[model samples]
Target: MIAIDNKLISDEVLDEQFVCDLTKCKGGCCEDGDAGAPLEDWEMKEINDHYEAIKPYMTPEGIREIERQGKYIYDKEFGWVTPTINGAICAYGFRDEKGIIKCAAEQAYNDGKLDWKKPVSCHLFPIKIQKSRRDPDMEYVNYEPREDLCKAACSLGEKLKVPVYIFLKEALIRKYGEDFYEALEAVAGYKKNND
Candidate 1:
């Protein structure tokens, strides 16, 4: 593990390669999860504040689900999370003509209707965060490749020689900060040379 700022990062983040193959995966991660996308308190507030703007981009069912669930819901295992439609696909998801699920929140963001680009948790795909049981302030940030859904991404990453950290640079920087990402890059370089 690599210690950076307040988080402990797994080596797979540096060693493993990954690049989302959206065409192949069809955004199945948004639909296949047992639970909804994890949410922070602030994210819940953001959704509530911007629901009207985001609503135009979502499915009627998704909007109804979100309204019925009231922004976010708590799961016994996953804490606070976005609501889902029929206990599947995220309430903020819509299917494209290609039969792939896409994020409505992101569509709104891209359209300049909102500043928030989807939730940080969703932005930082394949890198789930866990708060330390031993130290409340510490977090474990690791690469969690969902093999079934991410096989193409893994293959592409390896073919392109792009490490997971590099592929996820924008999201990581969004969740952490530019300095944290710079630190991560430095560490990745060191690890590459030392190994």
Candidate 2:
């Protein structure tokens, strides 16, 4: 696990071309079973609203099953969390008749009907948010990306136009500090321009 400071990242990294090839990964992040990154009050509202709007599209049995599992409970000791709905498969994920796994929120995004603010948790994955006592600020931490998780992030990065380095930096800074970020920047530069 790596901690990253959100302030250390420059806008250049945010706009770079870091692509994730998801077709090769098959939604590993969705399968890792952890969702609901720590939410601020506003973020919670957004998630609740999105859940209400998307509730109709979900299978009733699926919703019941998730409820039965107590997936909605927020535990202070464990932090804001939820069990993966549908046996660790995302509720929004499904197979088409041809057997291609699809993400409903992504499809909605493509159709231009989805609220970008909704599902705030979906955007923050693998990278968990933690509060910093040193700076008294919130920080993002990378909790060991599974091989498949990296692939899924690669895919989402392509769709969202975010670089993996940005994610990495954010995670690193939250867990470490400016010096760590500088070290990572040097390493990243070496990798980018190496012979």
Candidate 3:
């Protein structure tokens, strides 16, 4: 399971030998299918707006592709209420000159033409933030330091250089609040067994 929290973990632990070897596996995360995570109302709105803005650049087939997958519903209390699509890959997924899969969103962002309202989930790859089903108010676990398994399981893992925990904390705090940062910190520390 993916870990989500606001507490900061020591970078030292992050650098520990326990970190899984990622090179052995392909990026299963990018290619296997759509891995659903929650989204806020604002998040949904952003994604919709982006889709509209980029609609001209997108072919009808592209639009239909995403539409066929359906949109994710959001709930105030529950956060992202549903993942209506299956095998949902990001709009930006493509191969590079080196034959590695790269995110189009990142490329667009770098190109300075990306719609800021795109779903945060679209940009936040590998890293995921989920509210605890057992305790919605409480953030979930911090780090899922299973790079080896993740790389093996996720087809896009090879290109996913950033640590999942790092991305999750940064994305959550940016989208949510400082509370999320604190939660991530705690979880990071815990993952290190730092107490």
Candidate 4:
């Protein structure tokens, strides 16, 4: 584990390679998980504030689920999360004509109708955060690539020589700030030189 501030980043973040292969996976993470995308308090607030703007971008099923669930739900196991449609796809997710799942919130954000893009949890795919075992307050950055859904990504990453940390640079900076990302970059440089 690589410690920085209160977070312990798994070595897999440095060692493993990954890049989303959307054509292959069709955004499985948005629909295949047992729970919807995890939501922070602020993200919930954002959803409520921007629901009207995001509504038009969502599918009828997604909009109905959100309307029925009232933005988000409190899961016993996962704390706050976006409501899922029949315990499946995220309430904010829709299948495009290509059959790839996409986030309504992201579509709205891209069109300048909403300020928030989507949940940071969704942005940081394959890198799930957890509470450190040694210290509950400490965060753990875990690289959790899926075997079934991420096979193409893993293969592409290995072929391209792109590490997990590099692939998620933007998300890491968005969640943890510039200093944290720079620290990871520095560590990657050091390890590359020494190894």
- Relative to the true structure, candidate 2 reaches a TM of 0.54
Task: Determine which window of 10 residues in candidate 2 has minimal summed lDDT.
Answer: 1-10
Error of 2 at 51 (Å): 3.4
The all-Cα superposition gives candidate 2 an RMSD in Å to the true structure of 7.3
- lDDT by residue (1-195, candidate 2, tens digit) is 222334333333433434444565565555555452334565456445566555545555546755675434465653554445644656555555554445554555556655543244445444444555577565534334455456655567678766655665544454456787786567556656863
Q: For residues 10-96, write the lDDT of model 1, one tens digit per residue.
A: 999989999999999999889788789999888988888998899999999998998788678999887899899888899999999
Better of 3 and 4 by lDDT: 4
Write one digit per residue (lDDT tens) for candidate 4, span 86-190. Answer: 988998898889999999999999999988989999999899998756888899899988888999999999999999999999889989999999999899889
Question: Which stretches of model 2 miss by more than 4 angstroms?
Answer: 1-18, 34-40, 66-71, 75-78, 96-103, 133-135, 141-143, 148-163, 166-195
Model 1 lDDT, residue 76, Cα: 84
Residue pairs of candidate 1 with colliding backbone atoms? none
Could you tell me the TM-score of candidate 4? 0.96
Candidate 3 lowest-lDDT run of ten: 13-22
Q: State in Å the error of residue 135, model 4.
A: 3.6
